[model samples]
Target: MNTNSTEYRLEGDGASIQSLPKISLHDHLDGGLRPQTLIELADEQGLEVPAADADGLAAWFTEQSNSGSLVEYLKTFDLTTAVMQTRAGLARIAREFVHDLAADGVIYGEIRWAPEQHLARGLTLDEAVEAVQEGLEQGADDVRHQGGGIRTGQLITAMRHADRGLEIAELAVRHRDRGVVGFDIAGAEAGFPASRHRTAFDYLASQFMPVTVHAGEADGLESIRSALFDGRALRLGHGVRIAEDLLIERQDDENTYVSLGPVAQWVRDREIALETSPSSNLQTGAITAWGDELVDHPFDLLYQLGFRVTVNTDNRLQSGTSLTRELALLSDAFGYDLDDLETFQLNAAAAAFLPLDDRDELAELIQDGFDEA
Candidate 1:
């Protein structure tokens, strides 16, 4: 997971974007493996891989993800999850995931991954969770020893097409105090709406567990509505399609008159965070309706309209990006300055699944770091 030593700087100001504190809300664990580690793990498990060399493997993943087909994009995960069946492999990958985030200047991150997908090697649900927690703790300790600070939490995910939603929800609540910070539902979002897991959502609500559902990426406003009313999501995963609710009535010289549907109004008025990933969105055609480039993304419009827009790297390996690179791309797309970058980080900090006092502390830390930068 070693990136180039070349720093990403804000245009005109020449400020290093990598030095600023940040928060990641939509990162995936199985999607952030190191290429070299994957090679070693696959060799150890006697599994066949698409490439023998690290560089070749990285290129294969990027190419597969950019194929413009969701099915093709998802096939890349088979190789990654193949090597993660063993406890040691899972622990090592989780450790490196945290190290990479810390290196990219992430002060806090919520790593989401489906535990049910990792049970192929006979590890129970609780064992898998514990193994990841151990690695996260080790990584945090390593960062502390190096005089850097980092904190992380697990957002246990349930596959949308599976029937284990209630089981996964209970697993999350069972480990809430042991590094699990929240619950999420991920996977195919088109035909499998959040309503399919209403029972699980009800149980989570009864237990007062925080939830964030993957909606509006492959589906439309109806899916997002179900995520809000049925799943009780506090945040939206790649909720970029929520922008479909905005209707442009007219455009004037000074301002453009627009209207918000009920769904858009509820999300904006309630300040629900949108975990927008720029590169991933384009690669998956999530923003194709608007256009085929980053400039056409609704991120700027949502931000201008006061939506709680936060930048993220949905899958570092699949997208071939980092949080630093994501921020750089966004800044390039919409003339954002250091203040704009700070605002994104602050919005993420405020939306974190942490306690109020901890959120305040995170906000202060972000402010101080931005001021210093």
Candidate 2:
């Protein structure tokens, strides 16, 4: 992404957004590499790159990802994952991912990626998870030695178009005690509903594992419904299209009457978190139903209706953004202040895959950080 930038602060009071404690729920491990690091890793593997230098590569990613199509945006990952086929490559990328998150003031993050995509390098599924864990530990240790603190966990993902959901779910459960915190299903959310992975979902439920399904992005409400009923998802990855269930009855100068359909009502009443990535949503045409601008996003609508809304950077490298930058964009779009930002972080903390005590600790930490700022 664009790494050369000044600090981001609130508009009026100039409160530093980068200094505030934040939590990341939807960040992808393969989607957050530094451009220079990608160049070096690709060179080591004799992989061909689209651009020669870091600046050129970063610009290429930005131009390619702005095509307003999820499939096109995903094509950029082929380059990133190609260089990540070896143990050393995976470890180095994951370690740098953590360091970058820490530098952006992320106190905790759940890094998601598909291990099945990495097995072309002769590593078993178990070995792939172990390599990522080793890197996460090393990154955390490096942060501690620098007088900073950061925590991270893995969210093992199964490609929705693939047929390894059951096996991937098993891998997540096997590593739950190590560093794996949750399970997820991603990729091509159109025809592949979560119901296709009913067997995996049943197994995960039997083991009492937490799940977050990518829905309401490329598809509509039925996809989200399947995620909830079939996949038993506790949170929705980029569940922005649940807005389709919202019915705006009438509008006037001062107030507008609105009604909620079953899906939106259930998500709101049950407090199922919506992991909304503003820029990624725009890039993928997820918000085209509403409009084509950041201010036109349904994020403010979801937040106003009291949905458990959390801000995220779905793919930092693809979107050319960070958690801090995402929050700033939202604040600028909706005129939100520090209290609004704090509420978003608190929502993410509540919806985290950690235990109740740990979630409470995170909430307190967030509140303390915002208060101090």
Candidate 3:
């Protein structure tokens, strides 16, 4: 997480995008581990890795995940999660994840990871949560000590394909006073809609826990429907497919006439956050309906049409990207400027699971930092 003395990046006399403050809402803990950290952790656990060196290992992940299969892409997590079976392993990765985020200029981030997947080494659910929380706090302190500033929170996740939804829900609520701030449901989104975990959703609702669900990424409108109706999700994780509800009637020279169906209209009017990861979405075919390129991404359309679309790095290791890189790519693709970046951060700050007062504070912090840059 070293930004020391690296001149603030300004491209072609334009403002430096890297120096602009940003908010990260959909980062994953397991998906953001460093290659060297994975190597050392795996060696500690006596696990076999696909590559021996850090560069070799990073290349292997990049290659394996290039096959364009979500399940295949997700297989890389097995190596990371294997090393993370121990408390020490989890702590180290979480700490380094925060370091990387702070270095990338993230002022606020919510790191999401499923606790159930990290308990293979005899660590109880609460024990694993405490370990990550410890690492996050330590990492934040480390960043502050390094003259960088960042605030991070955990969004406890439950696998949609798993049956421990209720257990994970309670775990999230149990740790709310500690470090956990919100709940999320990730993994396969096609068959396993949020309705499958109605019991967990009900429990979270009773506890007044905030929710964000992975929907409309792998599935279509019905999945998003279930996410809002069943999961009560305030944010839709990569809900780009909600664009399927749009009816493009014609395109004129000035304005393209389009109509939003009920679902799309509801999401637009309600201001649900779409945690869209440009590169990750392309790799997973989340934008195949539009095209296979970043330009084909409906991000611009969503943004132009007034959807609260926020950029994210869904999996940094697998996507081989950072939030800075994501922003750079988006700017390159769409010709966005500093104001657009600030708007996205403002959207994320508004959608944060923190209390209204805290969110307002974050918004002011974001405005202050970006204005200075």
Candidate models: Cα lDDT each: 0.92, 0.94, 0.89
The reply for model 1, stretches above 4 Å from the true place, is: none
Cα lDDT tens digits for candidate 3, 1-373: 1222244444554776667788899999998988988888888778899899987888887788776667777888888788888888888888998988887889999999999998898999999999999999999999999998899899999999999999999999999999999999999787899999999999999999999999988899999999999999899999999999999999989897889999999999999999998889988888889998888899999999999999999988888888888888888888887778889899999999999999999899989987887
Top-lDDT structure, candidate number: 2
lDDT (tens digit, per residue) of candidate 2 on 210-289 = 99999999899999999999999999999999999999999899876889999999999999999999999999999999
RMSD of 1: 1.0
Residue 54 of model 3: what lDDT? 83
Candidate 2's error at 197, in angstroms?
0.5
lDDT for 52 (candidate 3): 93
lDDT of 1 by residue, 1-373 (tens): 3453558999998999998999999999999999999999999989988889988888888988997655567778888988988789989999999999999999999999999999898999999999999889899999999999999999999999999999999999999999999999988789999999999999999999999999988789999999999999999998999999999899889887889989999999999999999998988888988998999999998999889999999988898889999999999999999999999999999899999999999999999999898
**Residue 87 miss distance in model 2 (angstroms):** 0.7
What TM-score does each of the candidates earn? 0.98, 0.99, 0.97
- How far is each candidate from the true structure, as Cα RMSD in Å? 1.0, 0.8, 1.8
Provide the lowest-lDDT 10-residue window in model 1. 1-10
Instruction: List ranges where model 3 is wrong by over 4 Å.
Output: 1-13
Candidate 2 lowest-lDDT run of ten: 1-10
